[model samples]
Target: MCNQARFLAGAIFSLGLVVSGCSSVPYDGTSGMTDSNVRTSIYSTLDSTALVYTNPAAGAPADDNPWRWAGFVMHPIGVGLDYVVNRPLYSISSTFPRATGYTNEDAMLDAYRQR
Candidate 1:
């Protein structure tokens, strides 16, 4: 019974991974930003870890803000998550043809600016 349960769980997880790769949208930054596709959603979620280290006020001088302190405290954690979890997943996903997501930060930023 225990073995059967483990097999069933593995099967379900594998199915989820396979189903997630079915997106027809290309990962050209802009298309992924607009398209409601699984690959883009996953990439966006992972990439959002960058926010913790980024300044809350864009193009402005750093001020004595509490949010800046919070960001300071969280910066190391965000960096670790980006390097360990996010980048690794992005690297793995990019290996599969037609499964490439937003691996380029510059492209993603350009897309966001265009929007």
Candidate 2:
């Protein structure tokens, strides 16, 4: 077929270029990848999820961090309207104890609620 001949010609040309030391990429490009590396990296990361979880700084922190808190605070505030809004279960139980004279959270909330 015509397409087959063109494919063979391209393959032979590539081989010839490599043999003659004519093939190359610029310094800015990847040393191994002929196209993009991101698609490959995405697939590779999905394939190796354990590699991400074991690392603390793997994009998202599993533990409490102020950065994490700030990001979710807005979304939770929005969604929370559903759960606590005008519901019989919604007692005005203070989410945080009143500002304790001490800076401790437990003591503050406890003191706030007059518990």
Candidate 3:
């Protein structure tokens, strides 16, 4: 059934991550994996990290919210790449709404600087 497609999709997504270096920023400030940049990287990183830690099996989904799986699955490797490729002044968390929502885009931008 359709469930298989999602599993396949998750596999493909993970494969894409590995094949494309699913790591971090480009020298020109973009995701070497896709068209993503530090902005996308941070947002995706925090977003995914939240989901996977919150729930790992979901990170390799087979349902309507499959997109939720993307960031979570990518975080482990992506975060490593983030630390390696960038300065990593500090890491923000999802503790306070004063900064922003579930995504860390605003804080990442506010605190963003190159390594």
Q: Choose the strongest candidate by TM-score.
A: 1
What C-alpha lDDT, on a 0 to 100 scale, does residue 72 get in candidate 1? 89
Tell me the whole-model lDDT of each prediction, alpha carbons only. Answer: 0.68, 0.57, 0.59
- Candidate 2 ranges beyond 4 A from true positions: 22-115
lDDT of 1 by residue, 11-104 (tens): 9999998778646646765553433332312123356765566654453334536798799889999999999999988778768635565457
lDDT for 11 (candidate 2):
100
Candidate 2 residues 2-115, lDDT tens each? 999999999999999767663463455355665333222222333466665565345342343687767777887867776778442344434433432344776678789995
List ranges where model 3 is wrong by over 4 Å: 1-63, 88-115
What value of lDDT does candidate 3 attain over all alpha carbons? 0.59
Worst 10-residue lDDT window, candidate 2: 37-46
TM-score of 1: 0.31
RMSD in order of candidates: 24.4, 19.0, 23.1
Model with the higher TM-score, candidate 1 or 3: 1
In order of appearance, the predictions have TM-scores of 0.31, 0.20, 0.21
Model 2 TM-score, all chains together: 0.20
Expressed as tens digits, the lDDT of each residue in 1-115 for candidate 3 is: 6999999999999999877774564455443555222122223543656755564544442443666578779889887987876534334434445554645576587677642
- Best lDDT among the predictions, by candidate number: 1
